[model samples]
Target chain A: MLGKFIAGKFLQYLIVIFLMLTLNFLLPRLMPGNPLVFLAGEDVGFMSSAEKEAILDKYGLNDSIIEQYGAYIKDIFTGDFGYSYQQKRPISELLMERLPWTMLLTGLGLVLSTIIGVMFGAISAWRRGTKTDANLLTVFMFLSAMPSFWVGMILVSIFSAQLGWLPVFGAESAWSNYSGIDRIIDIGKHLILPLATLILISVTSTFMIMRYSMLNVLGEDYIMMAKAKGVKEKVIKYKHAMRNALLPVATVFMLSLGFTLGGATVIETVFAYPGVGRLMFESVLSRDYPLIQATFLIITFSVVIANFLADLIYPLLDPKVGSRNG
Target chain B: MNTVLSVENLSTYFKTDKGIAKAVENVSFSLNKGEMLGLIGESGCGKTTVAQSILRLIEYPGKVVSGRVLLNGRDLIKASDKDLASMRWKEISVIPQSAMNALNPIFTIGDQIMESILIHENVSKREALKRTKTLLELVGIDGERWRSYPHEFSGGMKQRVAIAMALACNPKLVISDESTTGLDVLTQAQVIALIKNLQKKMDLSVILISHDLPMVTAICDKIAIMYAGNIVEWAPTEDILKNARHPYSQALLNASPDLGNPEKEVVSIPGSVPNLVNFPNSCRFHTRCPLAFDKCRQENPEFKEVRNGHYTACFLEGVGNHG
Candidate 1:
């Protein structure tokens, strides 16, 4: 039964990947204007029409739309994502270079926020009508309502500008000739503002979902049964109630991971962090079709895969889904 | 017959927006060791509230306003959180109304059983697992399904798992609240029979709460008929069936389907119970009582013994004088 479920989920992921890849090919090509002009900058006006045609033809942008699509799909299997117009480099190479920074920022942000959120959420739900629940819920509500990028900026204004506590720009220092742990520590210092901002924003969204879900789970009959069965408050809250409540939170967490990518776009721009989101932002403005398409494809793929992972992980937590009845 | 549970004038109320909703009021009963006592009532008659209040498991907006729930000589109603924590599942445990909802869905049957065993007893994981397997066996579920989750089990099997969890700590009193309602008829019989067999084998005292009269009578030696938060009558199962004197008990008996005599028309009591927020100051059952008189409409009858161990709270009989 579980095997069938896994197989079905895998097929669903494959279908999504196919549709998204097709969209990646067709979407940016539909936009007008050539990216070669932006890459050429001021020299574009001086160049003859024949020169423009040559540049377009060289990148295979002059090919028929169907041929381009076929090449796009074929190139994907070959691990090629075309070439960046501005960088004059492989789009795959460009993204791979920037991917690690974005991953470190988002991954650290997501993990820390999830832990903090689940703990606070469960506590708030347990306390329900108390002052602690009220205070934390109110603060998180305000934090959630504030735009995350703006929150990032506020942190920058306070910590970087006023307090002079942390750096405001880039993934790491170019000036410092340090290597190894010293360089890693420099990167960590630069990471604080962006990571903290993401953590604050993500925690609000996550805690609210968890708190509501925990409250509902706490009301379920089994919770009361646990109480009647002499289960300790700690055991009942964490093991029984939190276990059931975590299911909904897991789906939300996966979805939030997707949004954190989108948030990184705004955050990277604010911090000037060298990440794929920043690359995507810059490429979109320059209308770098290959780079834009590749970045978009990666974002879409991450989201779809995250949800697919949720589907796979959910049945492990809930045996009802592992059975044929599910 | 030594009294195992002695509840005196137990009253539980809910603080709703409207007013204090008396869910259970002036309800008193006693259970002897190794005896099954059924508290039978229709839905919303405060039977479940009585069960929750017994364990101090009443959630917010609900409170045990007044009462004494004595188990083995200690009053649980007055016990501290620390005392109650130790008392629960060790001294007294409850089998909830719906077996399907009572067991946590995420937990395996073995884990759920082991949880209670581990909680009230100082035992290792291996020992708890052994006990869980034994408890599952006691409930007639195959020991192999111990690691199976609650959702993996069928409704009957879930009920058995609940029974196993209830028995894990070997509590003195087991409160079974509508424990058979959610199952098929066959499973209901099996569960009741299981409870009966377990009760005898373990020397247990049970408060079997259900609306099904025949099902309750099958196992319960003593029975209490409740109406609108009041225990209208208390008697032996056979006495309540053969010589019930209160109007509500009579109506309750008539309403229940006669298994042997299918031709007899099942009589359903008229009018739902009044809104509990502002329950009638007089007899709570007078509105639905077929033989309600001026006295019943003006004054509530106090529960009193009319015959040896047979009690009723009705002014219709020449007993329970309101003045």
Candidate 2:
């Protein structure tokens, strides 16, 4: 039974990877203009008409869409994504440099926000209609409604400019030649604003969803039974009510984590942070198709993996979701 | 008979946005030790509310405004929250209405049972677990199935788990609020029989609340017929079934199917229950009572003792041959 479940989940992820790769190939082509023009530089108006055809031929754009698709698939299997049209460097190298920063920021943001959100949500539901719940709900509603970049800008103004507590921009100072721990600290210091923005944005929605779901769970018969059985109030909340409440909220949290990934691009761009979100934003503006494709593929795969983990953990959270164990 | 559980003038009200719901009012009854008393009432009649109020488990907006739930001479209504918590499951346990869904699905039946034991008793985990196995076997479930989740069990088995949990602490009383509801007939009979056996063995006083009149007649020693939050008839099971004094209780007796009463016409109570927000100043059952008179609408009937140990509430209590 376990084997069958594992096989099915693995198969679903395989299908997701296939579709994401296909979309990666198709989405960039739909963008107007061409990366070849960017490669031709600022003197494109004076270039000969024949020179344009030569550039297109060199990049394999001269081939039909079907032939290009086949070549794209073959290139993927052979670990070759070609060079970036605008950067004059390999697309893979650019992604490797930028991807890690985004991963760290997003991963940290998700962990912090989820912990904060779920705890507050549980407390809010446990004390429904209280002043604390009302205040938290109102604040979250406002935070979620505001865009991540705007929130990032506001945070930057208050903390960096007015308070002078943390750095406002970039992963690190350009003039600093610090090494090892010092450099890590510099980057960590810079990570606070954008990180806080994304965390606030992600936590607000998760808190609302968790709070609502927890209220419903608290109304279940088992919860009442727990109280009647003389179980401690805290035990009833965390063990029984929270255990069931988290099933729905966990799904929302995972989905929102993916959603937060998308928003990170705007916040990263705002802070001038070198991450996949920033890279993707700049690549889109410059029409750097290969870099954009790599970022899209990574983001899509991360979402798929997150959902797959959720599917695996669901049986642990709610015993009624019978898989192999039941 | 020593009085085990006594509820006097109990009134529980729910303060909702729309209005104040008088869920239970002037509800009074007492259970003798080792006696199985059935509380028979239809849905929305505040039977479950009465049970919850006794435990003081009623949540927000619902308050036990005025009541005295004397369990072995201690009024739980006046008790502190700390005292109530301590009293629960040590002296009184509850088998919830939706028994199948009462146990936590994530935990094994054994763990859920052991939780109550470990809480109210000074027992180690291993000791509690051993007791859990014994409790499970006592409820007719296999001791080996202790590690099984609630979903793995049939409806009857799940109810057995709840029963095992309720009995884990060995309280003096168990308020089983429709533990056999929504089960197949055979399963219901099995659950009922199990309860009977456990009561005798444990010397338990039980308040068996259900809408199943026939089942109550078969198992309970005394029966209390609740109508719109008031006990309309209180008598020994045989007497209530043979000749109930109240109109509503008479209607309930007629609703039951018996092979001997082939010509007896089954009559459902006419008119739905009145909104409990402002329960009547007169008889709560007067709206649906066929024998409702001018006096019945003018004044609420007191619970008068018509005979020894057979009490009823109706304006025509001693007037005529009503029941």
Candidate 3:
């Protein structure tokens, strides 16, 4: 049953990627004016007519639509995302340079937020109606309501500008000549503000979801049965109750993971962090079609992949889904 | 006879928005070893509340105001947290209602049963597994099918698994709180029969809480009839059947359709259960009791023994055939 479910999901995601690829091919072409003109750069005005046709031939844009589409699909599979004339670099290379920074920032943020949020949420639900629960709820309510960029500025102003304890902007102190551990330390210090901003905005949603789910699970008959069985208090809370409550949170975690990988755009902009989100923002402004298409394609694919992982994991958490599904 | 559990003067109240709802008021009963006592009551008569209060499982808004739940002479109400934890499942366990949801959906049947055993006893997982298999077989399930999750089983099968889980650690007292409720009538009969068989074979003391009068009369050795949070009559099942002293008990028996006597009229009891919030200081069943007098409305009746092993709380029991 599990094998069949995986096969079904695999086929579904494959079709989704294929359709996305077709759209990616058409979006840049569908724009008014010639894509070859964008590819030729500002030199297009001085160039001969033969030069413009050469640019179109180089991209295989002069071929029939079906042939161009076939080559587009084949090129995507081979990891060839075309060239960015604006940056004078390959789209894939540009994306690769920025991917790690995004990964590190959002990766740390996702892990920290989920852990802290889920733990505190479980604790709050276990002690619902207490002063501690009420206080935490109030704080997270405010945190969740605040926008990410605004929170980023507030954190940056307080910790970086006012306190002078951390870097104000960018991922590192440029030209500081730091290396190894010293360079890592500089990056870490720079990371604190944006990571905090991301976590502040993201954590509350997980916390609320976990708390609501835990409260409902705590009231379930199985939880009562576990209590009657005389299971240890910690075991009851963590194992029986928390395990069951984790189902919804697991899905949320994966979704945020995918979105964060695509990049925390607003937070990244506020921090001036050199990540995929910053690159995507600039690429859009410059109308770097190849770069824009590549970044969007990566984002959509990552989101789909994350949701796929969630589907695979759901059955492990809930046994009923595995056998009953298909 | 050895008394396995004795609940004395147990009153559990729920703090509702209206007032303190006396869910279970002054409920008292004792079960002898190897015996089954059916706690019969109408809906909202605090049967489930009594079960929870005995186990001290009542949550917020519900408190056990006054009670002494003595399990084998040890007062569970006064037992410390550690002591209570150690005694649970080892000494007493419950087969909950809605067996469909009683077992964790994520865990296998064996793991759930083994958990209770491993918590209370010093045993290897292999030994626990062996015992779990025995329990499953004893409950009429295939021993090897313990790997199955709760959803894999039918409703009756799940109820059987619940019974198996309750008996996992060999608890002396097991409370089956309407565990057969959601099953079809045929499946209900089968589950009830399994419980009866287990009680006799294991010499287990059982409290079968249900509103099914005919089923209770057929299987239980004793019956306690509750009316509006109070047990109005307690006696041997035969005694309650032949000479029901409480008007409420008689009304309940009359209301049930007896398969043995299809010709017998099945009368429905009039009036819903009274709202227990700030109830008046008098016999709670006075409004529905045919023989109620000025005295019944003026004060609460005392529960006292009128005959050997027979008890009731009606003023008429003391008045000697006044009806």
Ranking by DockQ: 3, 2, 1
Error of 2 at A98 (Å): 0.9
Off by over 4 Å in 2: A256-263, A322-326
lDDT of 3 by residue, A180-200 (tens): 999999999999999989989
By TM-score, the best candidate is: 2
lDDT of 2 by residue, A88-168 (tens): 888778877876787788878888998888899888998898999898888888888988878888999999999999998
Winner of 1 and 2 under lDDT: 1
Best by lDDT: 3
Clashing pairs in 1: none
TM-score: model 1, chain A: 0.93
User: In order, what DockQ does each candidate have?
Assistant: 0.74, 0.76, 0.77
C-alpha lDDT of residue B279 in model 1? 73
RMSD of model 2, in Å?
A: 2.1
Q: Tally clashes: model 3.
A: 0
lDDT of each residue in B72-177, candidate 3, tens digit only: 9999999998899899999999999998988998899999999999999999999999999999999999999989999999999999999999999899999999
Evaluate model 1: give its lDDT: 0.87
